[model samples]
Structures are given as C-alpha cells and as structure tokens.
Target: MREFDSYPTPEARERELADLVAKASATIPGTELIEYGRSVEHRPLHVVRVPSPAAGAVPRVLVCANTHGPEFIGNRVCVGMLAKLIEDPPPPLRRLHERAELWLAPCLNPDGYARTHALDGVGSLARLRHNHRGVDLNRNWPLPAGARRLPLPGAGSSTPGDATYRGPAPLSEPETAALDQLLTSQKFHASANLHSFMGTLFPPRVRTRADSLAYARLCEALRQAQPHTRYLRIASRVFDTFTGEQEDHQHHTHGCWSVCVECFSFRASLAQSFARRVPLFWRFNPRDPRPWVDNDVPAVAAFLLAALDLPPPVSPRASRTDP
Candidate 1:
C-alpha cells in the first residue's frame, strides 16, 4: 500500500481549484469563472478567464489539462500556473498577462479524474484513460479533411473498452463536445492541451509546408523559453496522420495555433519501471509533481506569447482544407 501523500485527493483538489478561482475572481480585476458545460456524471466543466487589460482586441490563449484520467500532473501544472498568475507572475508570465487573455480549463475530464482517484493507486490501465462513459476525449474530435485512419498502432481505436477508443462518432462524448463548444465560442489565438510522460510538444497535423514551418517556429519558441528541462518539439511533418485530437481541431477549424504539451518525462517512466508493483496511475504521474509543474507553467506562458507575436490570421474560422 503505497501512500500518495504528495498528491491531493480528488475531493481536496476540487475544493482547492474552486477556492483558487474564487480568489482570483475576487482579487484579480478581470478574472471570471465560466461554467461551460456538464460532464457525463453531471459534473460542471468550468474555465477561469484571466482577461488582459490591453486595449482593443487582444490574443487569447486556452490552456487545458487532464483529458486523460491518470495523467493528473497536467492538472497540477494548470493549478500551479494559475496560482503563479494570481500571486506573482514571472517575467514571461507577466508579459503574457499584459498581452493576452488567458483561459484555464484545469480538468477537462473531471469524472475520469475522480474515477482514477477512486482506484486508490491500483487499477487496470483502461480505467485511467477514458471518461465515465469509457470514451477517450482526446480522440473524439473531428478529423481533418483527407485524414484517414492509418493502419499504424496507437493512432486511435473504434472499440469501446480499448484505451484510445474514439467513441461512436466525432464529438460524441459530452466532455469533448463541451470543449468543442468552448473552442468555437472563444476562438482562441493559441492553445495548449496538456498531457503527461512523453516530454514532447506535438503540433497539430500539418497539411502544407507553410503550416509545418509555422508550427516548428512556434514550438521552438516554447522550447527556448523553458526555465528548466525543455521538451522535445515533435512537429508534424507533411505525412503525419490525423488522430482527431483537440489540437488538430483547434488548428484546422478555428485557425488557432495549438499544440499538445506532453509533460513529465520518458526518462522518469524508465526510472519508475524498475519499481515493483507500481500502479498504472503512478506510471503516468509522478509521486511528487512539483518539479514538472515548475518546468511547464512558464512554457505555457511562452506558448501564448509566441502566438501573440505572430501575424493575425486572415480569418478566425478555417476550412478543413485550408493550411
């Protein structure tokens, strides 16, 4: 019975998140708490808006985490970043605050998070990847035009019980639908969906050379801005297969610069592999999440600032075939 004392219980985390949002709303002049939608288990999906005081139209950035149940480190990063913004933002974060409106969706799959925590550090891997209705929210987005299902493994699955199960149809799950709605309404200039244990920044599927170059530049900015260990930039080449991921939908349909930040590290996974009886949750999340949070929170700010510096898109809504 390994005690995960370092990580907060699901109930405690929820309370802390609510408290943080309340504090920000009360203390920060332009902060707001928006309840976008409800989950399968009737849990409220919320986003905290920290609006910029910059005049005229400003860039907006969406930072979301915890799409996968067991990868709670991403959630920790979001909360920690929010705390920093509320208390004392560092140089990059302060610059981001001055230039962009930031929205934080700390836990996109709250039901799945609670379910994973209920396992108490012991469960099958399948239970740690899906929502209460067993759908992988990350894989439930709309696929881009000309993007076909590849024969490659880990692309995503159509099966219900599998880890990457994409659900019966695109945007079928309530969690994904709620996120899609937010993206549609907000029309963010840039976004980062946080995941864990890959230590890589994956851009959305690229269809053209120009798109690929743009993502490469954006990811390079993220890498250069990290105060600690930098994540590898796994930019999409021309032939990368579309996985109906949120980042792809954001980039293709909304013309937003979106990337999936896979936090923690593969090296950490290798180190944990030697431990006996390590639970599936522990494999995805570290026992102590502070270091990863410290490393990633600033990178999130850099991601937004880089996008804000880019030339404004000709149109906010892009066709599937548009680059």
Candidate 2:
C-alpha cells in the first residue's frame, strides 16, 4: 500500500497515476487507462476507465480532480478511491462496478501543479493557482463567446495573474479544451469535478421539482457515506457562481448531472498567532492527505453509486399532465 499522506509533485504525481493504472489493470478484471490529451506544457492527461460487469451500455460517471492547481485534495481523494476499488472492492462496490462505468481524471492542471511546486513547498502557501499561461482552467470552458468577460465580483477575474482569471476566451486553454472534448465526445450520466479547501459537496443547479428530489437523494447518499460532510444544493449561492465552469457546462451543455466538490478545508492562518506570514497556499490545502482522502473518497464513491440508482431527471413539462 502506498502512503498517500504526502503530496506529490507533477512528475511524481503522473508516475503515481500510471502506477495505479498499471496495478489496477493487473489486479482488476477490466480496467483501462488512456492518455486523453496534453497540458500547455505537454503533460499527458490520463483517464482510467473501470468497466461494469453487466456491460451493455452502462451509465458512465466521470470523477475528475485538480482543475485548480492549489486544490490538490480532490486529486488525492480520487486517487485513493481508485486505489480502494482496485485493491479491495467491497461487495457493494463490486456490484457498483458490475452495473456502472467509472472514469477518473486525477490531475487536470499539471502545468499549474508543477509550477506551484517549483515556486513553493508544503509549509509555504504561496502556490500558483493558474496554468503556465496564467489562465484559470476552471474559468476557461467554452461558454458563449460574449459570456467570457470579467466575471462578477465573486465569480472570476479578467486579470491574467489573478487566481480566478477566466481566460481571454472560452475554451482558450488547452487543459479546459481537452476536458471539454471528453465531456462532449461521450455521454456521461453524471460527473464529479473535485475541488478543495471548503469541505462541502455541491449539487449543480436544480430547476425542476424532480431534479430537486433526485439531487436530494444523491446528496443524502453522499452525506450518509461521510456524515461529517455538508451538502449544498446550489453551489452558485455559495461561491456566487461563474461561467465556463466544468459542472455548469457538463450539466447544461452535455446534459450530464455534474457537481464541483470542495474536498477538504485547512486554514493555517486561523490556527496560529503568527499567521501573518504564511502564504495563501498553506491556508488552501491540507498539510496531511490521509484524513481528507479517508473521509471524502468514500463520499464520492457513494455519490457515484447513488447516481447509478437515481432515476433520470424529468423536465417540468414532462412531469406535468396537460389539463
């Protein structure tokens, strides 16, 4: 068993992911790993597919992490979950694999992750959040061309170096485009884009009553898996929302049920009296990866399981009877 307590740099992270895929393929009956695309600095984006047993067109669920460079906790959670499933899948989990397909993209922003690692260490919170080109990958989705402006106060930024800088145009960044391609190419029943430092599980916008109920059950399943976690229905209200985001694009454009998960929280600044000097990175990511992985990965796994069992969301008109 690999000790996931410490964080890995970009190269190390890629190697770890490769190792995970290799081991999984050797151990699990049907595990496939593919190089989906490349980052700005040419880092290969890898996706691991775990097929179902009853396999004629099973519902696909995407579990992606590390869209934001500094928020690495989700990546750890995802990797841990994959490891668990590969190593010793519980009977229920085995049943899940027998019914639904699982896809995982562990690190989406390799350039930024590597850049941040080059600039700062574990104790230093001065990490880089944007890619090598300084664009925020989360904000670079292919939203309508006009919606690509400086986002509202809490939404996103227009400034290149700023943390929330939405690029000059939608799908402008390669990383976002690569992910966009994946979402658009295949039909994913649901997706969980993992993020961090907030400790909350958010469901995408729920417009209809059926959508609301389905999400409620899904959130409950996640909560049941990790009782300490909080479930927020509309993430927009919490973060004030932004365009070109993965969850929003997945749900709206691709018709996939998607949510951005804030994996774990840690604020070193609030913990000590000498907090004035520590950088923001120290505050954004957890120091040790074990607790966060142990608590949140199961919740993610449970959510995927719940999604498989959930009835498809019905439109308002479809749910209403003509009088």
Candidate 3:
C-alpha cells in the first residue's frame, strides 16, 4: 500500500496500472481487462471487468477512481481491491466478483498526470482535480443540457487555467465519452467515483428534498461506513452552482448510482495531518496536504459489500441519451 505514496512517474503509474490489470486478468480466469479509450497521450484507459462474461448475473457494482490526476490514492485503493479480487481471489471476492463487475479507471487523465508530474517532478500538486486541458474532470461533466447549465462556465470560468473549467461542450473529451460508453454498456447496481482532499462523500442527487432523499441515504450510508468521511451532498454544499458535474449527469440521465468522494488532503505538514485526524481541534493548520498513510480501504471495502447487496435504483425518467 505504501506504493500509493511512492509518487511514481506518470508513465510508471500507467505501467503499474496496466501491469496490475494484466496480472489480475491472468490470475482470475473470470476477469477481463478492456481498454475503454485512449488519453490525449494515446495511453490506454484500462477498465478491468470481473466476470463480465458471466451471464445471468444481476446488476453489478462499478467503482472508478482517478478521473483527476493527483487525487489518486483512491485510485490506488480501487486498484488494490481490484487486483486482490482477481489475483488472489478470496472465496468472497471471487464469488462476489463473479456475481459483480468492477470497472476501475485507474489513471483516467494520463496526459494530465504525466504532464503535471513532469511539471513539478514526479506526481506533484499539479495533478490534483484537473485533466491535461486544465479542466476539472469532475466539474466538466455535462449537466441536464439546456439553460439549467447556468452561468456558462458555471462554478468557475472557462479560462484554461481555472481548476473547474468546463470544456467546449459536454462529452468533448475522450475520457467522458469512454465513461459514457462504460455506463451505457452495463446495468450497474451502484457506482462510486473516489476522490481525496476533503474526505467528504458526495452523491449525484444532492438536494435535501424528498426527490433526492434516497440518493442522500445511499451517500450517507457509504460515508458512515467510512468514519473518516463526512457526508456533504453537492446540492446542499455547492447549491447546484457547481455545474457540469459527473455525479449529476450519471444520476439524472443514466439512473446510475454515483458519488464523488474527496478522499484525502494535499497538505504535508504534521499539523495538517493532525487536523485531518481531528478536524474539530483548533490550532492545527496545515499547509500542503499529503495522503493519510492508511486510507479508508477497509471501510470502503465493507461499503462496497453492502452496496452490492442492494438493488439498482430506478434510473432517471428522462429518455436515455449519451451525455
């Protein structure tokens, strides 16, 4: 797990991700690894599927991480579970994965990861929350297209340097399109896109209203499973002011269960580490945040187990269309 913090070069990370996938495919007879699409660098976006070939299974669980470059510890956690499920398949993981499908998008923005890593020496702060185009992958998702996508540039401006810039249009990037294809191709029971920094759990349907209660419930349960994470629904926090979000697109359009988890912090100081451990404590201010040595892996694993046991929620009522 310390490999998660070793800060590999962008190429090394991609190679490691591919190696993990290949190893899993070889180790688990039922698992298959497919390349969804390529990043701007022509690096393959690996989507490892467990028992996707298995027929007659109910809805499956799809967990992905690293849509952004630097917030990748979650990606590491996802990859670890994936490799474990396939490579040294415990009877539980083997049987569960046989009945479930996991789609791990390890390094979704390879171009950004590589470029940023190069910019500041292997895997630096530049990799956080943005892709090669300087756009935030999480913030760039197409909302219910139409005027609802207010403020044109939404939470942030379209300036390339902005952290949350929405691209020219929805699905303008290969990453988004590849993700769309993955969602359309399968019937998923539940899905969560992991993140780090704030340690907050987010849901696609974020409002506190009745229409979104169930979604909130799911998010809360997941967060509760990981005590380190505090539940912070987007609608309540961002006021839908944050437009073009992946979670909303997945929830409103695809009826897919999705979430955005702020996985860890960027601060590296001891004070920062202490604050994260006890956010309520005073006099503990951090500068740059580094990932917690031990992440929420165990809790996240348990949550996945519970989520898979539940049925898929009703998809949004809108006519299905790739966003």
Candidate 4:
C-alpha cells in the first residue's frame, strides 16, 4: 500500500480503495460493505459501512472522496486514515467508529477519474468532470428545503469539464440519488467530503458575509485540532454557489455538519501543482526537488480525529434542516 501511495494514477485510485474495502471488511466482523449503486459507466459505487447495528444511540458519520474525480489526494488520505484507525485510531475516532457508524465512499466518479488518468492521449482518453451523462454529480443533488439553483460562474466556467454539471434536475444522477437517499435515511453527526489541490480546510456554501456562525464553529473545531491548515474563507460564500454543491445540500438538508476539504496542490497551486500532476503510480525520485509539503496526509487525518472529539455545536437534535 505504501508503495502505491507514493504515486497513484487516477484510475488506480479507485482500484486501490476497493482493495482496502475488501481487506478491511474481512478483518472486521460486523463491518458491512455495500455497493450503494453503480456509476454511469458501471463502476461500482462502494461504501464501507462500519456500524454497531445495535440500533438506537449511535450517530453516523460519512467520510467520502473522489467526488471530483481528478482530486486524487483524498482517496489516498481516506484509505490511509482507515488503515491507521483500524490499527491505532485515536480515542475519538476509535470511539466514534465503535459507537457511531463510519460510511466511507472513497470514489464517487470513477468514469471521470479513469478519463483523467489517461489525459495525455496515452490511452486515448480525455478527462471529463461529468458522469457518463456529462452531469456534475455534486450539483445534481436535491436540497432538503426550497433552495434556488447554485450560484454559478459564467455559462462556460474554467472549472474542469470532467464532472461539475448540475444535470437537468436535482437527484437526476444516480450517484447523487444514492447519497441523498442514504444521507436522508438517517442523521449524520457530521459528514465530510474530501477533495484536493487546495491546501486548506473549508466549510460548504461559503456565504459572502462574516462566516456564518454555524460554519465558523465547525471551522474552529477543525482549525484548533490542527493549526497547520491554511484556514481561509472563514466567512465567505463561495463565489459560485449556483449548482447545489453536495456540501450545501448535505448540510442544509440533513442539518449535518457537512464539510468539504481540499487536500493537495497538484492543480490549484502553481508552486507545486506540477509535482502532484505526476502520476502517483509513476516511478519518481525522493531526491527530486519539488514544491510540496509532507503534512497533507497527517494534517487531514488529525482534523478528522479532532472533529470526532469535539462536542457537537448543539446537543444532538432530531435532525438539522436547511436547503
């Protein structure tokens, strides 16, 4: 696994996470591995559900990755954290997983990932930000309350073409449908969606004004846990909040502390973006000089652990409602 971690291609990211699920399930007795649904290209939508199943009392948490397809760092970090949790989880994580449930979806857009992997025409593949139908899985989600369309940029945004389309309607895509239903079925204590290329931690639906008190509280918990993170946009609505980003839908609809974290700088930062662009699976040199930080993985892992330890912003309500 460590060998694969050094350099993982986008296509290989799903393959590796699937492998971890299989291994982890076999090792844990009550663990439930479910295929929520299939992607547009028939890529299995897999999630490792670690639940007590005793019912009543335990809350739920969903930790996901690969929702953006090209953002590959979360895939590695999710699996790495899972491994660590199994072997030596901190008190918060151990207890959280033991009492509450952990729903880990390491890859959401397998097709987009596959396309991104062979972008050089090395495999005659062009990356897309959409599912098979060319829809953005994130934007197609249905918000719980009556919310308007996501605030988007221009008609043609520089956003990657791979999978950011909002589709014709909310819950129009299977990926969003599966997640929306699953998340709604039960209230999650907190949910986090992982991404990459931004060396920062942020909340969903950044508002234009001061950090919404709700988001600010969650951000504080994360920042205090790990002081190294580039805590930006503490109180800024996303410039483009049009298409019902998954984070917004999840937080507003379920009233869960829905957070979306960007992990590395392969694309977002010119300073070291070139380094991450190199296929993680491709052989590279430790001695090779690159603008990068070694803390990406640990930083995220610690933040997650801290989240588990912190008290909920409010005593557990039956559920939260926003749209």
Per-residue lDDT tens digits of candidate 2, residues 1-323?
Answer: 02223778777887888888888888666787888889988988888987776737888888999887777777888888788888776444566677788899998988777766665633222147777787878867654222333336635566666667777877778888888788767678888888876666667554556665677777777767774545454443333443557775676567777777877643432462133565455555666777777777777777778887765443221111111
State the C-alpha lDDT per candidate: 0.82, 0.69, 0.58, 0.57
- Measured with C-alpha atoms, the lDDT of residue 285 in candidate 1 is 81
Off by over 4 Å in 1: 312-323
How far in Å is the alpha carbon of 149 misplaced in model 2? 7.7
- Give the higher-lDDT candidate: 2 or 3: 2
Give me the displacement of residue 99 in model 3, in angstroms.
4.1
User: What's the distance in Å from true for residue 155, model 2?
Assistant: 1.5
Query: In candidate 3, what are the lDDT values of residues 11-130, reduced to their tens digit?
Result: 676677667777766755656678888876677887777654457855567777777665546666676666566546434345556566666666677776566445442332423446
**Residue-by-residue lDDT tens digits, candidate 1, 102-149:** 899999999888888778756876777899989889888877755676
State the weakest 10-residue window (summed lDDT) of model 2: 314-323
Candidates arranged by TM-score, highest first: 1, 2, 3, 4
List the candidates' TM-scores in order: 0.94, 0.84, 0.75, 0.73
Candidate that would win on lDDT: 1
Q: Model 4 — which ten-residue stretch has the worst lDDT?
A: 283-292
**Candidate 1, pairs of clashing residues:** none
